[model samples]
Target: MAAPVPLHPARRAVGEALAPGELNLVGCSGGADSLALAAAASWHHRKESGPHAGTRVGAVVVDHHLHPRSVEISGQAVRQLKGLGLEPVRIVSADVDCDSRQGPEAAARTGRYAAFRKAMSELGAARVLTAHTKDDQAEQVLLGLARGSGTRSLAGIPAARGPYRRPLLELARADTEAICAHHGLTWWEDPANSDPRYLRSRLRTDVMPHLREHLSPTIADSLARTAAIAAEDAAYLESQAKEIFPTLLEDPDASGALRLQLKGLRAQPPAIRRRIVALAAVAAGAPAPSSERLQAVERLASGSRSRGPVQLEGELEVYRGARGTAEYGKLILIPPSSG
Candidate 1:
């Protein structure tokens, strides 16, 4: 048998992420990061003997149609993926809603992910690998901070969520660019990535560069490290909250309103207490409350001031049981139409 060929570090990383005999799709966008990922995935699947030996790799290109030449760019990516010997290369067009309340970037992302899901379902792929590099993780953390987000938000892009996997999270953007250059691949530069109208674009083009110059040359790495730590903490806290949550719940009333013993809730530390409140709200069919609203719920539970039912999204309400009643000293979450 011929000796196994050595692989590039990026290619090895991609190979390690794949399971043998699985059908995986690379989410390519003709950008340097995604092109490099596509190249690496192709290299991994071509290996005749290894952990990823029987892996079948394909590519999915989502055209958001935000730019005039979006279709042309997607065609280029498809040709490149085919050139790299990737089979089942698919191009999906995303219908981005400009009027979406989440803004253009998020709207486009929602549409893109929907397209990915459709392609995955049609191709019977096990997972879709994206090219969210370390730099992207750092930017996400900064964005979360700017929005005064909680630990979960600051946790940045997860390495894997559901059927989507990001194997390049540890690789720097520069490393992906180098890989593309080594493969003699020409990648597209998306203008929207640098447009000042977007907050992330401002951070990437201005804030990040300024921080790198004055704060630290490795600020991006530092931010990415913070995100990892935050992810760990968030996961641990959520697990603890889930464990303690069921014990605190009281049987639902005749109207299906949920209740929790205030004593059990107060016994928990603030972090765990707030999480339990959020969980209870969600269980009562309400959307997760904002930080300030969560704090308000806390006040309603333990505060001296008189405050009645706290209104939440999804037509749910939370309040402390009134004194002298069977429901006294309990937190009640009233679902819609339950009175």
Candidate 2:
């Protein structure tokens, strides 16, 4: 017997994630990946047992309003999802806001996820699924490599995060396209996909093809494998850091300043230690801290024992003040004043 089609695993993924008496949502973008996912999730929701026994399948189309064709694309997606028996279909616009320093892609992603989270809360959905195939994972790994980011960035898109899940992460993009073809389904190809102005678009159209043609036809698979390994390593290191993080924090000051012990931080492996500092930085409401900024934090921690307090960009300050026989002092993170 031949192997089952793309929807086979796709349905199984949805079943594992959902149970009876729950609502499952698919984030559709009128693209092949999401369209295939919606179809599979709808099928699974109609199943009798195993999982998704009494679940309802719904679709949420997020319109970033970035282009003139956004509304038309969203309408087409809604009609297709409705035809596939998706329920409670609706479209929402994302309010994309970002400073000049931020790129358009990053701003758009921020807006898109915000919209998804809002929809999830309002709809009371158990989980929101987006179709991110292996192609995306590979692209992410390459992008991370180009940026020289640490292992976490190279780890690629997670299968599940918060209330969002990517059920198609293990599948290839071709599988989704095939699934659409099999069902006689039509999908939208966003013009942005081929627009060289975007890094991702260029990577998808030019770099990846060149790499596959010249270096290896299996480049995507190789990169995806690299991401999987990186993710495993990152997950394990994160768990260790979580276990050790509490040991680094000292008692809060009268003004609610939180301190992380410099000695304890220095004792940890570089990976875990860096993660803890990054976590504290984020907790203090610092914007995405770059490697240089992170290194600055580390320098202050290990620098002159008699030096004055060093201030981080997030209003967090650290100084060499003794706390319980520890003269090197602790690194304290301060939040920006609410007022």
Candidate 3:
């Protein structure tokens, strides 16, 4: 009997994340990382036996139309995905709002993910896989640190969120490029990635290289490791907060305001407490509070000297209940338009 051919590491990685008989859509960008992911996913689903039997792989190429040649690039990606035997290969044009307050990179990302979600719904795919390698993870960590973000931001990009999954987080950018080369694939290089206007692009071109040279040769690996540890810590804290969150709710008022038991909230550690507050605010139709806003909420909940009906984003406000009322020692999240 012939010896079984060894699976390529990229293919193995893709297969490990995917389950049998499930339809998955690869979000290909015609870039090295995404193209390699698409290639590996196709290879995994092509298997007629073993773990991946009956699995189907499709592809979605989102064209943000940010660059002049975006449509052409998307067409090339679709052709490549089709060549790899990916069924239902589709190209989606995203209307990216460059003037968004979130900035260009974030705006483009928002548009891209929206397109991915729509494609998944239309294609009946169980999950949308994107190529976010270890290098990207490291970049995210650096960006978070630069912005002085909290543990959740430092945790970097999640491996899986909702219907989206990133299978290449364990692989390096070089690994993806190598895989693409091995497959004789020519990937498109997005100019935005190297443009100095974007902070991420600047980091990729200048800061990261400087860090790699001056700080540590394996700085990306170290950063990725840090992200993994942070992710574990954040996930545990979030789970704990979620478990305790419902117990703290003290029944909503008639005007659609949400109230939490201050005593119960104050008992938790700072990490869990902040998360719980944020969760409650979101549940009450408020945008996710910023670090500064969270601190303000914390102060209000702590019964600080300043009595506050603390104004939060999305027309929501947080107020501490008066000492004599039935709502005493409660943190009330007043919804929009509630007096």
Candidate 4:
């Protein structure tokens, strides 16, 4: 990785980082990071190529109709992109019910990503660039820790995925803001971001400051370092799992439910076995079972004579057969009725 650079340099770095055949779909949210990213990408494109066969760069702004001002802000963002000499793709808004106990932010994010992925596929986008700065990564790690999440939680946000990339992951929040300001860009300040109703807001406004004052002044940087370490460890663990997982997982339909080879699972170490089960759940899009659920599944597959089946969350069940043979199963996902 090279040293951090100015806005234009960062844009050039992103352009150079992409593969020769790759096309970019920038996610612009009218915020500092995204605005800066759009500007940087435009500058990079102008610097890298002639009018013919120039690198394809477009912008997508997802309108989550959560507030009255959301539509206006999204339009402004698209206009900003157009002003920057880029084509703006508009994604129609979606309504998500965020009244769950888990809070609205998470739900909104889930829906936003869904829409983003849909738009990417519809537009034949090769890769989607996001505006996650280093501070966001640090904040995510802290929030995950506060939730008592497992090792995966500590890994924070990923830099690259199937179609998602975060080119500004190395940049700080202040630097992103400065870049946008230096270019005379304007953005909307999400009111919900400042509302104390959200945990992340409280953490950003209160906890981080206290930590900076009392504990370590470089807490954000330290948290970012911790997230990096956790990401490395998680990657190693996933690699190990990948090597061992093939033997444990069975083929399934489009629904992704798999039958586990209980005999092979039991032979593996307890820790590895738990990870295998968790990974299976993740692959199935079902939440990972609790420790007790894992232990129950273990007992169901073991030599113990259980008269009944071991039931777990998400309708996952494990039943034992005549001679230590066991079956792990899950209910099929039923599509919504067309009525």
Candidate 5:
């Protein structure tokens, strides 16, 4: 067998995140990024000591079946994983629902995460690592900017979400490809990455190239830095909102909806105020509210007039009703009408 190429930086990140002997699962797509991650994880396992000694590394390739040869691609990934001596290799099929309002990419992403959660549970894995890199972060920032998204959207991809972690968020895509080449590993390139139909593909293959050539030489790195700063700001704001939430939310009604008292909420900064309203909506069983809906609820928090009651998607309604004071009423999340 050939020697596995070393990935010093990635190894360090994975090592710091997980204890020795713990199971580390990689979400591999046969692409260069994930393939390199798998190789790096294997090397990290080989060097483990203490309780982490003999750490088990595995790969879960989620097959969305959106293409004609997805299964073939998955099989090739399995072969490559086995060649790297990774155990517990599994391929999960995801049911992607495209009929909804969300874009195709989002639907697939949702399905893929569900599969990863299931894999974690069945494998008893302590962590799941993905291949999202700094380049992906730049693209995300661009999308968020184009859509006029808030700080949370501009924060781009997080390094860690629950049990899932992206250890390569600081690394570039070229680095992953180079790592694969150094290991003498072959990686499968997905056709979806190049298809112009997807906005992300256009951003990756064309828009970024144009910007790199004509715009600032370090545009990608700069955007990635923006994301890091935005992430920091978002974390602080979220912590503040959580602290203030208990005071703002009145007792739940018969319908289990939490009412937001304007007396305390109206004085907070807009960022924290919006987060409070959005969190209240989600807590009341509304799926994450859109930016427009969030703003609508925020206006209600201020006791705005002229505009009628705010009707959010999923039949969740938000309105201001007299509770404590006439001048400043409370904003409430009403459950979807059964009728």
Candidate 6:
């Protein structure tokens, strides 16, 4: 109803991350962060007009259909988007089996991304916006470190990947809440966020504070900086891999069995070799092998062969040859069969 305020710093960050006039699809979850992002983007679209001015900016909210009230919450999100002058689009609901080990959180995330991707494809959106913030990045880094993840995992969430972008990654959750308040908007908070039963919730409510008290006061910022540095390093590593991966990648068939010569792989440095193996495993949809397993694979390539096919979680198998030849030390990633 009122003229939108000039772009706040948070909104400016969004505008900078995603240039104005680009066709964007926002993944709005009715949460404070996403609501603020949607409102900011809408304002940006309104104030600027050009060849890209009329550029389409739409909203998609995944119901998740988890809790009984999830549908109602989604409806509220739609109304909020409409209030902010966005055309809201409904997406297909995913039937998530919450009983899985990863639990409802992982299922919802998987389903949410799938739905967003589908909507983006259908709408021909050049890019999609997510509301992952600085706090989330910090949390991710801590979680990854707690799990003893490699530098790749510590890299945290990427700023731009394929059709996805996170404009709010530089801002904290508090800033999002402030932006919503500035716009006279109220948001629904999911109760699950406060439920201590979830590991993340417990970390946020308990572990982080304890760490802040006993450890460095700037732990969050430090972790976030580590993540940023890791991301830059990871990007450079990937770029390097691109130059050699083609030669290193094994021949592929319709069945999607890909094998690379471990001998050739060992010629590269440890970092590059591990990256090649991890990338291959991901392409094969197998759980990425740990650093130890990758080291073992390297040993096999160097002629110290494993007794049998070295299997990694997610179906990636590394075969050791007896002859210590390029053909003998082969790594194959067998793709997951269709369910």
- lDDT per residue, candidate 6, 222-285, as tens digits? 8889999999998899788767777878677677777777767888887888788777777777
- Candidate whose TM-score is highest: 3
Q: Rate the local accuracy (lDDT) of all candidates.
A: 0.89, 0.81, 0.89, 0.71, 0.84, 0.76
lDDT of 2 by residue, 1-339 (tens): 744567788778766665466777899899999999988887865556654567888989999998899999999999999988988888988888746357888898888888888888898887788899999999999999898889889999988887778878888889898888877789999898899999999999999999999999999999999999999999999889888887787766566666787778888878887888877767666765666666666776675554545566766665555547554466767655621
* Each prediction's TM-score versus the true structure: 0.91, 0.91, 0.95, 0.81, 0.92, 0.86
RMSD of each: 3.9, 2.9, 3.2, 5.0, 3.2, 4.0
Candidate 4 per-residue lDDT over residues 207-255, each given as its tens digit = 8889989999888889888888988887887677667877766776554
Quote the positional error of residue 171 for candidate 3 in Å.
0.9
Candidate 1 error regions (>4 Å): 1-7, 253-256, 304-307, 337-339
Tens digits of per-residue lDDT for model 5, 189-284: 888898999999999999999999999878889999999999999999999999999888888867676677777888999998988887887788
Tens digit of per-residue lDDT, candidate 1, span 30-90? 9999999998898876567867768899999999988899889999999999998898899
Task: Give the clashing pairs for model 3.
Answer: none
Residue pairs that clash (backbone atoms under 3 angstroms), model 4? none
Candidate 3, 1-339: lDDT as tens digits? 843322277787788777568889999899999998998898876568898888999999998888899888888888888888999899987879999999999999999999998998888889999999999999999999987779999999999888888989988888888778777788999998999999999999999999999999899999999999999999999999999999999777779899999999999999999999999999999899888899999998987976578988898889898889977888989887787
Decide which is better by TM-score, 1 or 4.
1
**246 in model 4: Cα distance from truth in Å?**
2.5
Q: What's model 5's lDDT at 327?
A: 25
Error of 6 at 2 (Å): 23
